[model samples]
Target: MSNFTYRKDHIPKGTACNRRPGFAMKPTTITIHNTANEKSSAANERAWLTNPSNKVQASYHIVIDEREAIECIPLNENAWHAGDGSGSTSGNRTSIGIEICESGNYTKTIDNAVMLVAQMLMERGWGVDRLRRHWDWSGKICPRLMYDGGTWSKWYAFKAAVQGRLNELKKEGVASVSDKVTVKAYGKQIKDGKLIDGTVYVPLRAVAEARGDQVSWDNNTKTATIYK
Candidate 1:
């Protein structure tokens, strides 16, 4: 489990003209954005999104800061952060928005976002390819700090950091392996491991024999025994 605090302060269900409209989505991708307001905390962003007077039709799913992550909108519902509107395959319709706050400690905020995105991808059995930038959808230089004058070095590094965290999470056994996973044991590599219900299963006999252990099969008992 992550140490970061996660809170859900969703918008009310029947708000006439606020931000969220209850539009349903499957969220095939994750869109990253920078709040660009260095003074706002995660809680402040949540408050603004859920406030009655904020008439802007802009919103996001998760807002992260140095201290906590707040969910302003549900993941199953679309947010208006992406400028591409609600067309099919548009980022607003198909992506989960994550706005990283630049208040307090910016590096810690980004680290939290990396962990959060990694966890989401692991839960959905998705790869880093599903992660997107706000610019990818509508050509807006959002998450602008990472863009760095369009050099994209920071953006690439951010994605690499998220993928690294995802690998660590998978190694911790928190996520199932959807694709073929290579198993290495005792300095030997096994490639043909069976994938059963997201778990990798290797042949017992093959592994034991490779380790120089004697393997015996008892037909009557229907048991396989390994003798070292």
Candidate 2:
């Protein structure tokens, strides 16, 4: 996971533009978009959305650039992104909008977005299948970088990267070695390990057996031996 900074700068509730006041969102998927403005940073996008003078109705949950990720709106609220009209299944109502800023190093910006999306998915217990492009909701050619000659190779690659990070996060959740430790020996998984004080204690016999080794215990000497 990239060490990208994150902060929430939410647009005021009941804002005349950019957000829906009474609509609550239960995000089922994540929709990706490109800011389409090359000169604006993620902070700039958040400021624009929260500016009272801004008349555009477009808003998103998060904006990510090479340096940081700013949340302009609460994830539980409906953003006016997704050109599809408000409906039960519309992207605006069912999806979390993520706008990737086009300024700064494009590759690093994308990497940060990938890490953010993977973390979001891991929190929600979602898989890569929940990822969506703006084009999927409407016919708009949004997140233009991910589309090429009517193909979605870049989008596919982005999803693959998110999945890879998510898998790593999931693995990190296992065998924490805090209160207890879960061990995976070769292809076998063992959860018979415990953490005592500052040391981790594991069943030597179980671990040896998992590695296909013959373990012999001597009660007289209180010793154990492993035969390879």
Candidate 3:
């Protein structure tokens, strides 16, 4: 459990909500980005995060807004976040992407994002070498508004900053991870290798075995559950 939380309900509060993706595994990297549209109200943002088939459906795992650490997609399964297309993580590779909600040039949000990412990295036992920007791998220019002023000349400096934050979080020592998951019969969820959230979605019988859970479904309730 991560102790990232806001003292109160407010954007920019930098609250870290601990949400178990209901899976298990070590995360490889952390991908950060910004949401172009403005979702001021909690209800609107919640709807956008939960709705499947929407333009932004099943894309990112964590949606960190003004003061929320809304975990949308499951962590163990890939949520199509990085890579301009599929080539980047095409072969069932994985990464954790955090999409910060902001219209443009959001500095404070970026600060919180950076801090949160560093904390996550430290928690996941990832090295600084694993830390990367979308552009670093796919050569894309997302999270454009998060830049201090479009001056990437200080790339090394930014890296240093996140590293420091990561180091600090490591010292405190309070974070968690999910490595695998089980899906119900006739109901599976994975975006690429990442898992998306939805009722009666894809099938993951294969993964269920690896997760040590025998898949079953209660026809009456149409429900599925996995016990450690």
Q: Which residue pairs does candidate 1 place in steric collision?
A: none
Report lDDT (CA) for all predictions.
0.83, 0.84, 0.53
The model with the greater TM-score, 1 or 2, is: 1
Give the true-structure RMSD of model 2: 12.5
Please report the TM-score between candidate 2 and the true structure: 0.74
Where does the lowest 10-residue lDDT sum fall in candidate 2? Answer: 172-181
Per-candidate TM-scores read 0.74, 0.74, 0.55
Which is the better candidate, 1 or 3, if ranked by TM-score? Answer: 1
Candidate 2, residues 83-149: lDDT per residue as tens digits? 9988989998988899999988999999999888888887677899999889999989988988886
Query: Against the hidden true structure, what lDDT does model 2 obtain?
Result: 0.84
- Please state the error at residue 95 of candidate 3 in Å: 1.0
lDDT of 3 at 22: 32
